[model samples]
Target: MTDIAPPSPSSSAEPAHDRQNLIARQPILDDKRAVFGYELFDRSTAAAAHTAASDAALLFNALSYAGSEALVGRKTVFINCTHESLKGPHLELIHPERVVLKVQTLGEQATPEQIGELLPVFESLRARGFRLAFNQEVLRRAYASWLPQAAYIKLDLLAFKPELAEPLIKFARSYSAAALVAEKVETAEQYERMAALGVRLFQGYWFAQPTVIQAQTIRPSQATIVQLINMVRQQASLTEIEELLKKDPTLSFNLLRFINSSGFGLSCEITSFRHAVMILGLKKLFRWAALLLTTSRNTGSPPAVGQTAVVRGRLMELLAAELLQPEDCDNAFVAGVFSLLDVMLGVSLEQAFESVALPQPVVDAVLHGKGVLAPFLELTRACESADEEAFARCAQALHLSNRQVNWAHLQALAWAENLDQDE
Candidate 1:
């Protein structure tokens, strides 16, 4: 790798269009079956046209808003880069060493003219120490010129015929220095087939799916989470809440630590659970407790998934604050956070909720995706999925403008990032 400095993504001033961006990542593994890196998908920018600005916006948000350390750790991040996006100023914002810019094909049938123009940009990026990745189609004779510049070539298992796999592997190995990556290897059979062909890296759902630990009893921390929720819901007195906190020393410490976190902006330190609860009040305390459940450090689920839940809860609350009662906003927060309890608890949603008491609206939203809080929950999901039509529909149904929704989405992501850091 060359000595070019990583782009200062946080310092870059992004346009208004970039503010609402969110990232989703798929893990990539090496032959030894360890996590090698991740392919970052900019789900928020999914609805936009493939332009340099949009692509740059995605990279900017991944690095700045979601945070590089939290998002990719010390692994490579694969980003799709069009010919135009590769040449854009945004490429200047990324660190080259752990980032692979996958140059997207120009079209279904890219003409020689199109490939010819992008060659120089590819060469320039390569010379600057940026590793280039491409799809298997780049192996065709017409695109042969790009072969030497490639650092990785991905073959989609579902896209190519099984018979052609061997030939493609042979061609890639003999002709280019690029490491071969097998994409969409959704089963053990496909994984073995690709490994037999000397493909060194693999990605798809099969490797990453959560293994549900069925019939497992709840953990002490999780039970505490539920107990706190119930106590807060029943509006327990200060002495009762303090007694509950005293039973779990760790919970008390975490509660104090969280209250004093930078995001809270407390004028003075919150030294005790009672003091913290008094300041936060029941409504805010419940929101904090519900959110704390997702940030449990011991869960099998990825921290990012839990963080996504936190974002959903915060987004729902922020959105609801504009259109609903303060109590309803609290319910919206609960609905959003509890929506992922099944994934977090490794049981069905019904099984997960049996222990906790929730409002009818929150219960309906979490269990049936119906009730007053349902639209807010749906809007939160639409933001995560970048489902533009769903977002518009939900926003319209809730009588919310795009600006309100986008502002809340950005704020929620920023809040989640801060919360992760605090944890």
Candidate 2:
């Protein structure tokens, strides 16, 4: 008979309030069309209101919880901030050099005086080694006070007429040393026009859209990951886990790297699998395994897919914790993480499951879509899609409120972002 331990305590606690925000990132490109950096934004609100609380949530989620270093690596991360947010304490948490604060106006019709008043804030930010980005309005003579400290001047191609590009570019060149960035460049012609005008940096869909590349065959390490998860689920002995780890060096390396990562918040470095198991315990070890399963893909899938999987897993785990037994929550997490095995491994769900034995509840939720955990998995997936009716249906079916679902969703996103993809 198989000995299955009871589910471990929930790894995450619910938030005090439902402070939910949808985070999205757009890739900024250079003249050669190579990715330069990402413009992180909040998709929860339609307009870029630039409120202090919204700004704080975006930056806090990115820098503190998301592990900005792991998310963007050494690339500069451009974040939108209000004038008030610039003075807020959130800026203190970031590595100023790695972040470029895109400063926005106080209101839609911000006056020259309003812009002039924040010149000192811009200067102070520059003195602290932080860079500032501004929009085309900074080129106007009325806002001259804020132009000199600009690191980047973003020209909204959609907002400004094409005929105004050269003049604006010339004005910006003469007044500020900031590089011109053409945002919303949606066509090859726009890219060419911008390049001709000496606009070297850009952000838009003209360069490339986000995609998931499917591999024809799975790697050995991927198989080992599946096997390891199975072993952990069955409560395999430490020796067995160690032997499995030894068989796959990639998995072993990733395991150590993940445990030692800044997100894990360990007091001491963990060197071996036995030490990791001893320190993290089987329950926590299972969480790490789920995370590694997504990120350790030697396959050609983009890091975004792995990142998305981690979020799904964590979201399901958190949601399940609300109503299900601890063991069911564990299965819910497995179901969620492995839900995208098809996309990550580039195989059919059945083929992916054939490599290793998984819990039937998880299998039912992912493959058959009929089980106790199936509704949770469905609700988790609906949160990512555009089908609002479906999301509403799924949430209603599960008795999960919008606030409850959104809170869990945001927490999952942050948890996933905190995972370091190093190694």
| List of clashing residue pairs for candidate 1 | 7-93
Q: Compose the digit string of candidate 1's lDDT tens values, residues 313-339.
A: 778889999989987886776677668
Q: How do the residues 1-423 of candidate 2 rate in per-residue lDDT, one tens digit apiece?
A: 233333232222112023343557778999887889888876644554546656655654443233344455457788888777788644654457768899865554787677678888888889989999999877766777878889999999998889988989999999999999999889989889989988899888776553321212222244556677788888889988865653343354345544554334455656445676777777666655544443333443225665676678779989999999987876776677667767755668886554333568988888999999999989988999999999999999988899999999999877665444321
Runs of candidate 2 exceeding 4 Å displacement: 1-16, 19-21, 45-50, 67-70, 106-112, 209-423
Against the unseen true structure, what C-alpha lDDT does each candidate score?
0.69, 0.68
Query: Once model 2 is optimally superposed onto the true structure by TM-score, how far is the C-alpha of residue 25 displaced, in angstroms?
Result: 0.6
- lDDT value for model 1: 0.69
Ten-residue region with minimum lDDT total, candidate 2: 8-17
- Superposed by TM-score, candidate 2 places the C-alpha of residue 143 at a distance from the truth, in angstroms, of 0.3
TM-score of each: 0.47, 0.47
